[model samples]
Target chain A: MKMLGQKNNRDNREGLKGWLNPLRYGWERVSYWLQRLTGIFLLVYFVGHVFETSSLVGGRNAWDTMLEMTQTTWGHTFLIMVIGASTFHSANGIRLIFTHVGIGLGKPGRPDYPYYPSSLNTRQRSGIWIALILTAVAMLYGANVLLGGD
Target chain B: MRELDNMTVKSDKKAGCDPRDDSFDLKKTTLRVFRTNTAQGKDSHFDSLVVPVQRWTTVLDSLLYAKSYLDSSIGIRYSCRMASCGSCGMKINGIPRLACYTKISELEDPVVVCEPLPNFPVIRDLVTDFTQFFNHHKSINPYIQNLNYDKTEKIDEVSSSHSHRQSREEVDKYLQFSYCIKCGLCYSACPTVATDTKFPGPQALAQLYRYYADSRDAGKNRLNIVDDRHGLWRCHFAGSCSKVCPKGVDPALGIQLLRSYMLGISKDKRNV
Candidate 1:
């Protein structure tokens, strides 16, 4: 396939060589990788977090010990990563859902036909925004709980 | 037309007879019936028709018997009475099955429920407007895309691979999908088609893959058609279409193959 492309004359554009067109193909490639990586990472973390939470069934001390671990730097970092991944993943999912459902991108401030507030693309952007805001709040709350700042 | 008139007359005469007569042995049984006319709202209901069970009776027979005898307005659809012509597909007792193919004796009832095939706009009772279903089939350009070719040389002489003819597995894969009578049983059962009308239904997609996989179609131009948004990518591998196909055509599998083909994983033989 590479050989065929090289043999073909279509590959030889003189001017636009280095710069990538992010709109058409770049975002697609980035989103594809991000969605896959985030899904795998979040799935692993979800299982581990669920198992750690299950330790509370033993006693209050076990629960407190679990909480203490979450207060540490690694735990905090993991949570942040999870929030970022979840946001990206869910936003992309919303985008896909919209596209599949036949609700194309709609005008700004104009409600979608049959009264959906936003189009699929807009809904995806909103999902990402919501995830980011919630993540920021959660991080702040976690910090307050850990450092006794609140 | 003459055969149809004869059938109607025979059915009418039979319906006029009393099954409760001393000459006829009757056993009380339940018939779970779906109640929704096409013009009505989606708030459909089911009614059980308890009647005498008989051997060699089909689900459609039970329905016609009930409608002809017990009630006149019990809406349903049927034509030819045989499984051919692709009419009379509905959910018989939770599975998408042809009413003609189902036997009452095999059912676990006294109670049998019937509903219109899912995922298409219901026309009336058991009848659905198959216009959309067929329109999508046509949209895929189901015929082999023809282009400038040797008119003098018959197209029948196109070189076909020995593997294409000799391999039973390859033949069988296409054959499974071939059994679809276009009854819309799989269409009704498919969640993707139900949720998104634009996504070409499973049967069409399966057939699309069929032509693509054929060794005779060496031209790779067919691959360009389904690479867009509403094409192969819309399939989320729900696998419901396979589950509900009365013909056992695994359309989900075909769509997956299509996805692989679009991604260039499945080698373009012309490139070789």
Candidate 2:
């Protein structure tokens, strides 16, 4: 079957700009991209975490050295990033759950000219706001813990 | 003359223009339209043209004006200039909108960027090939499959039976989804369809749910049709399909309801 938007050689001239056009979309699209990105980051981090923790099998000295490396500035920054991704992923996951369960969807209405917002639309917007707020709060707490003067 | 007068009046009301006004407005607007002509071997490019736009001038009207008066080479597919035909679906200022329904004045941007709907093969400037969209829509068997309909009876006479009659409440169940004009706008706006071509897409899946939700439909095995891979599970519920739908058919909501049904959690009263 012929697929739509299958890029030919001429169409292939444009690089990542087509998929990653930052200026062409709205906040919902931004959140969608970020959720995928964070999920990827979490997957990579999970593998690295398992490997890092496996250092304990090499004896107490190896474990101690691995722990020591995680206390530095760069390590703290990486940990903060991990915290942010986890928080955002969890919050957004909740939102996805709500959508999948049809929590906010009621009677579908006619799309008014000039665009009237629906109940599901409002719920999705609030979900994004809540996710953003939770991510902010989690990031700030992580930053305070890592950057605080002892 | 009378028919033309009636048409003008009806179109004016549909376009949200004052019917009393006979003269077209002289206000000009900038349109940055994507242009491509494979037959002419011309590379895809953005062409900007300034055209006079009235308060009632739709995006489709502006394109028509540009084609007729300014550039004759530009290609666009449109018919029935009303929203009913579903032929004028395009990305107006990065949103999948029906060109016939979108007013030029309503767009807040100074320069309106017109592009072909995303996730579809561009045939030319603002023209997309909808063959695959229709194929996928057809794959789901969109018609109401009444397994109980006796082939021995005349087709029209089958409705004479009182059992085939649906209550007002039963009609209300799938009534919202019956409004789908199959514009492919939902397919364009769907992020899943953008990446995964194997997915049945929002339009098809929504139609599947529409038929499944109908009380008169005796297709009890319908739920299992979309239960396979790249079906109900592929939709991530980005909600873009519902948001950009010109007809207000919330395909995202339909997909979610289908998902809930699959998971045995749907509150929908319809028995499978």
Candidate 3:
């Protein structure tokens, strides 16, 4: 995040076109916070999962009862949110990895100024398309599951 | 008495003068150290203390005194009291350095500032999570690979001259960086490692280059191992790692060398 600040803060703060015009800063913060939050969430989930699995020490009945409670409405809904957040966090992390190493999606001959173009080419826009597609699929599945269709 | 190297105070008496005429008292100094714990919930606050500073007193010495006398539960880590153990590294006045090696009296101000090493999870006051550092070190396979199989045949030791000649400069490069002690000061100082965990880090990358430089080792695929986007490419040459290295090992140079090696810019890429 400091690296981004060093390179982009001047341009980042100067923009006033619209709320969406300077989306990179918002996205960067969101991704960072979400990744950290999701990581903590996963850690908590792991601890709870291990504790729940320890119910096997009691008997098969305990394990079955716990499983039934976990498959209840609230539990299922929480699981869905976890899956979605985890996936988004992972994708954003990978993207960050690429960007940090100077992997520009733009062509080699293109000028480096004004990092993002006014219009993105097919290659430049592929990652966004992929993320949108994945989100759409996940939303559809989530609605289906909640509607008792899956 | 002759003045010791790096000593700031001078003896008042000349060669034949009486010692009783002059007196020396310890200098009163204030230390400002960052304070936090799990119960405190990450809102780090500063705590200050005044102590008498002597010529040979180290920052760690003051910290120890504070912990034992001032506050027993002031969390910190230390192993071998000497700098060899590397467990006592932290940020002193915004620079990551071994606390054991830094003298308290030499600092510009008595108001000493301290913080946990950056680029790592802080466990408590001065104690940081070194799990990531150790894991990265292990990832490079920090050992000699034994390839020869002998049922009965025993091979004589290779000539030291041959091995020595090949790795002379390479050994110098490795020898300095190899003394990292896993203290993680370089990792803390490095901006690249701070932002990107997958960057292999300056310490690990230096060790990576060390393995590639070994004459006994044939690491042909070394370049391939760390050539990815998450590897050498992420280093932006901030030079912070070199600035704070307690062992005087320039990890920034190692990362640069690795980058040049990956980009085919150096003449001795194979030799690293």
Best by lDDT: 2
| Best-first order by TM-score | 2, 3, 1
Candidate 3 recovers a fraction of native contacts equal to 0.00
Tens digits of per-residue lDDT, candidate 1, A27-95, equal 332344455567889999999989998998989999999889887777877776776677667766775
lDDT string for model 2 (B1-272, tens) is 99998998888766656536555345778999999876678888999999888777899999999999999988888899989989999999977899998999899667899998887877899998887788778777788888677888876687675356777767766776788898988888777777666677889998988888887777767777678777788777666777777776778777877777888786554742
> Candidate 1: DockQ?
0.02
Candidate 1, pairs of clashing residues: B30-B110, B32-B112, B32-B113, B38-B124, B38-B125, B118-B188
Give the TM-score between model 2's chain B and the true chain B.
0.87
Interface RMSD, in order shown: 19.6, 4.8, 16.0
Instruction: Please write out the lDDT profile of model 1 over residues B5-123, one tens digit for every residue.
Output: 77876775576434443445555677777677645555667777776666557888888888888866777778867777568888777656788877887875667778776565666
Q: What is the lDDT of residue B92 in candidate 1?
A: 78
State which candidate, 1 or 2, has the greater lDDT. Answer: 2
The reply for model 3, stretches above 4 Å from the true place, is A1-150, B1-22, B39-43, B146-170, B267-272
Question: What does candidate 2's lDDT look like per residue over A1-150, in tens digits?
Answer: 222443222221122333465334456666777788899999999998998999999999999999999889999899989999999999988888867766676544444555432424767778888898899899899999898866
Per-prediction tally of clashes: 6, 1, 0
Worst 10 residues of 2 chain B by lDDT: B16-25
Q: Against the true two-chain complex, what DockQ does each candidate achieve?
A: 0.02, 0.29, 0.01
Model 1's CAPRI class is incorrect
Best by TM-score: 2
